[model samples]
Target: MQEDSPLTEATSDSRGASLLTSREPSPSDHSGRGTSRRSKITRKSHRKSRAGCVNCKSRRIKCDEGKPSCANCKRRQVRCEYPANPATSAAASGLVDPREPGDLPISEIELTYHWATTTCHSFSAWPAGVARVQALTEEVAMKNQHVLHLIFAFTALHLAVCRPKRKEHYTTTADYHYERALALVTPEIASLSPDNCDAVLQSVQMICFVSWARGPQAGEYLAFGKHGRSDWLVMFRGIRTTLASLSRDHFSKTHGPNTRGKGRLLPPSDGPFEYEKQLMELKEHIEFVSEPADRDDNVNSVEVLQEMYSNRYGGKDGEYHVAFGWLYRMSEDFLDRLQRCDPLPLIIYAHFVVLMHDLEKFWYMKGWTHHVMSGIYEALPIEHKAYISWPMARVGWIAP
Candidate 1:
């Protein structure tokens, strides 16, 4: 489980470095759930393929390619079947042949490889003490947080790269990072923060949204597996419940006003004033444009205002559409930066964008009982397709 052990492998190191071991106990250990953890494990089943189940691949252990019966499956005693359909089987092959239409460019793939190797090096550089701490806690040390951050951020970077390029499958390494991040944000970590309420809220919203995007009912963006179908809806509803808790009073006294007459200041409770202003500006912009102008020169405040309330209160009939015009644009900007320059913060921002995008989608879909994304999706121009694609691509069982 050491950082040097590699992600594809799934074996315990005697050195006491276990990155991601199953501490929750395999499903067989408990009979309450319908499925066991062994069945839930994501593994490839092609006999000739070397990149097998993450556990076997990492340990360099032999994989039987047995559906419900691989070596790992037998060891863990779980089902190990491969995808049933041709399209899915091809995807499970995990071979990125450049000849494939949607395969990443050689340069991009090389960059990805380089980044991954660099991340591994960084992970390895941690003091043995930190590794020991992480092993005991089953979580990476603060030194390892940067690696996780980069992993989350890279999703937006890939989105930006995918914007101009229309490939059969527009998903990227970022999605995988996001999924892992969600998996990492356990209840243990969340309970550690009591003062950082907003941070916790934001994190919860982000995970919920990401889960929804990759859940069932994701339509065209269903890149993950079938589990997304049930998960998407469940997460969508959960997002509403979480966000609904955010009544006007939910704003911190510092962010909102003590009295009605006093102006509400947003920066203190959130991150910064500039971000709040930028968010407000985007909200205003979305309100302004969501209408039909009688004259191009005239400002149709009435139409715009109506659209605003309608969107906020849920379209015409309690149907909510998350306002993510700003979130979408910001993600696109970060992505563009990554493609044109170093892919660090830009990648990180992409994860931020994905998290926000999920929040917006969850607010509207499960909360409102309508396809709120349609309005948001339709509101944008063709130029914004890539921004939409980032989240849309997550609309599968288990978005990569």
Candidate 2:
């Protein structure tokens, strides 16, 4: 036989090498098999957790499985609700069935009603007025989304303010509902209509209280304070203007030359009433107090001092008239100066707190006088502390 060619010899060598390689596993082959095995093991070990509370489960976190409230939600101070079994949760909780036609979920309706009766009471300066507003709001909220959202927003804000442990949760809920109310009412701000006027007014009032709750305290002035009283004053003016417009429109429609003013639609305007006269007296007192001693020829004028005393505390009209009267007559410039932390305005504000003491019978104004007075004391300079002394004394605070 002829000697094998070089090409035939090489081919035979390649076939032998391929057979040897197939017999022994390479590094890459071992790595691929190891990875596949690990993946299968991981898949087998992973299981969905059904034992956790709804909040933890939804967040894909491990739950401590505490009863009623899980550790995760308890730590966060959020509502710890479990997933209700379709057959039993509603009945167990005493909740109305949500499937009924024309009926809202019981929780929502109950919350809204609670807010109207209980939470709203805290914001009203007058119980009778709040009762009437609550009745009207309940009647209107069913038909108007704007009113409904405002009620929820007020409820959430009240909870946020009153419940310190759950403040974050309630604040978030308040903001969500407030935004919803704002979105619905923004379009109607410019266009006033009889149909939406009541809802709009109620919403504005609730929003003002919400703003008050969120406004900066004395401790927060250096860091978190915004425009302070300037923003509140602007809202106050806006509310007044809106009410005036509503009153005018209502008057024109209901009263005519031939008809008596029998049916009034809007509530009576919040007037200074007798407080108007008291305001004039206060203006005079302020002038007297601010007057220089040298300018007065009668340095020991008993009559002037006596009149000042009478007006200062609203002698016969009572302190409420004097305090609220000053508030009613306070100028925009005064509010602006207050926001700027002007010493004089702060001193005046402190004095006003004395009047607030008498008005604390209103749930909304309770503790406010003390809070504002304390804030002023903390914020003022040492030299300016004397200016607040009389007011502080009036409010039963002793200087330290």
Candidate 3:
């Protein structure tokens, strides 16, 4: 129970005054003001939590007793956990001991709840698509431990972005599950078949999402990693090689794809022409380069981007694939240059992500445009940085 604030204050001050006077305070002590005022005060009784979290109790605050993260701890951006209830201890006998801040005990249910309710809806832009993806993710994750881990990984990473105060906590959890998913998925990838295809494909998508969502470091631009390695690219080639052995049925779609192609192209003041103009100027910039091999590698990359825009992609199609599908279509040479931080390809990529405005609106793709574009703009030299101004403006980035 909370102490009576006014009474406690008056009694303490009166005793201190008495000690200074070498006697106890009387009715006239301290000008006789606090005793009468304190006597008029009445303490209110309020209910307290019976099972508050340890974090809340230590801080002498109230707790809503939210699982996984209590309201107070979530607000404070710290870990929230309750002391085991003696009454429920037997029921929790099977729960794993949480090894670290990220490793939550008996959290499969909590994280899965988050996955089914919130994170699952992030993949698809439309309602029907959302329902379909949600069903598929739940159905597939049920029979696969790795898929479940992937779901939890994706959910935790999303939480990290949404709750910045708990970033380290959720990031660590995301990283733990991401690694767990890789360990379990590796064996199945070696022997991919129709039976495991659905699970494997879902896992693949989650992995890619998590990687991209986590942002790229200086040594890692786009799919490239440290020492100029095609990190995510190589990972895909392996999965692609294995998937090629399967049939068209393994990769069936609920709906045929839609493309806001060049046929829907608008005028000079509108998007298609203006967007293509940036890409066209990109190719022209590479064309003026002194090195033939350098010009060819970068120009072909820009051409691939231009062609993708002109042919199958340009407008808002409400399809997430339309944004990054070119990654699969891009040449290995171009991808290598991207990994190496080539100024031309880097600038081209900045333009490419302008197509990602729709994607950024997606829950998973949220903040990706800002995160990636900021990196690209920083990586470019001052002279080459001018190349990305259109994209910078498009994404609302003002370069410093």
Candidate 4:
């Protein structure tokens, strides 16, 4: 048999939809379960007409009205999304009008164009190597269909955040590309090769960006909630695992298996830190508010924060993933307390949210800091609320 390219396009599926969370495959799950549900995607039959998918009309482009994907979107290198009950919606909404297509302020082509130039840089936190990562991502994406689709997907998501009135349209567009890429890429994750390693690793990050940029999940904030670690963390943990699977000749060496579990001091910084004082105050309040049994656990949690907060990342503008180092190193017991909405952990997590706010300038991190901070404030008791004054005031979080 001749060799098959990894760039094979995904066929439209008639099978029932599944949640993205449920579809994420664990490394130990060699069953290839993620691809099983997608097995029923039969060939799609297109109904040609003047009208096309929702994205075409939204972008004011001339769509050829193909099912699953249109000629215009495919040619422009952007996501394709057909309306549900496409014929019915097209007929009812009168989406098609007889006129020449016009240019847009931010066209779909522009969105795709930004991916290599702008979106890819967000993956690397270090300023010195952003261009290198972006170049690698684009180079890999060109030969890999899965990586290309996710690149476009993330760009569409960024565009959605930029335009709130058209948020739903762009978000749906992003999901369409993301779902397709994920379906095709899931099985290949376990059996990575030299050729596909970088592409697959890049796709994993695209998955994280798509998940996080969608805004806060209802119950999940910063990977802690009633159900332990959120799905986001579940997916993100793969970055290191995948790196371990590969040689790491080029990928940034930041995410290697973190054995920094506990009892290690961070690289010391020279100066009086405000966060150190905040931690001291937090420890003081834990004495006042915690029950005898709970007090010890709460103190353990703060001590973990003390280690995380004791240093600065490259002096002020923190590294990209610096904020999340605490979450990765936190004990399972403390995570349980967070899931239970324990006041002390919530307050401590709020301080971490301040670090998360350091990345607030990024489009994905823009509103997340305030959102997580608000969740903490709401979860905290009135007495403990005072401890988060700095975080609350820092993020300008207003109570509902």
Residue ranges of candidate 1 with Cα displaced over 4 Å: 1-172, 188-196, 208-307, 310-400
**lDDT leader:** 4
- Model 1: per-residue Cα lDDT over 91-190, one tens digit each: 3353322123442233233333443333222222133423432232223221243233333334233333335352212233345345445655555234
Model 2 TM-score relative to the real fold: 0.53
Give the alpha carbon lDDT tens digit for every residue of 1-400 in model 4: 0012111222233321111111111111011122223467854444333356656787776666653456877665555555445444443344542112441223334555566446756755543455445555555565566776677688888878777777766777687778779877897797787656767777887788788888887767765654566777767767767877767664444322332222223234433356677778888988788888778877777776676554443353234465566776666677777877887788878877766775666778777877777777777889778878887776678777
Error of 2 at 114 (Å): 1.9
Query: Over the stretch 228-301, how does candidate 3's per-residue lDDT look in tens digits?
Result: 65455565554455556777476545311221222222222234457766777777877896277777767777
Error of 3 at 237 (Å): 5.2
Clashing pairs in 3: none
Clashes of 4: 1
Candidate lDDT values, in order: 0.34, 0.51, 0.62, 0.62
What TM-score does each of the candidates earn?
0.27, 0.53, 0.62, 0.62
Candidate 2 — which residues are off by over 4 angstroms?
1-107, 123-130, 159-168, 190-195, 213-231, 244-247, 250-325, 359-367, 378-384, 398-400
Q: Candidate 2 at 54: error in angstroms?
A: 16
Residue pairs with clashing backbones, model 2? none
Ranking by lDDT: 4, 3, 2, 1
The candidate 4 region of ten consecutive residues with least summed lDDT is 21-30
Query: When superposed on Cα atoms, how far off is each prediction in RMSD?
Result: 18.9, 24.8, 18.3, 13.6
lDDT of 2 by residue, 1-400 (tens): 0123111122244322111111111111001112224644553233234655656887898766554456787787654444545423444344543232442233344445457447756633345445544555554555556666666766776666577787788776666566767888888777877666666666665666565556435443211124354444555456556666765455223221122212222233232234345435544544566436322322222223234334544334322323343544455555555666655556656655655666555443546566667777876788888766766766777655
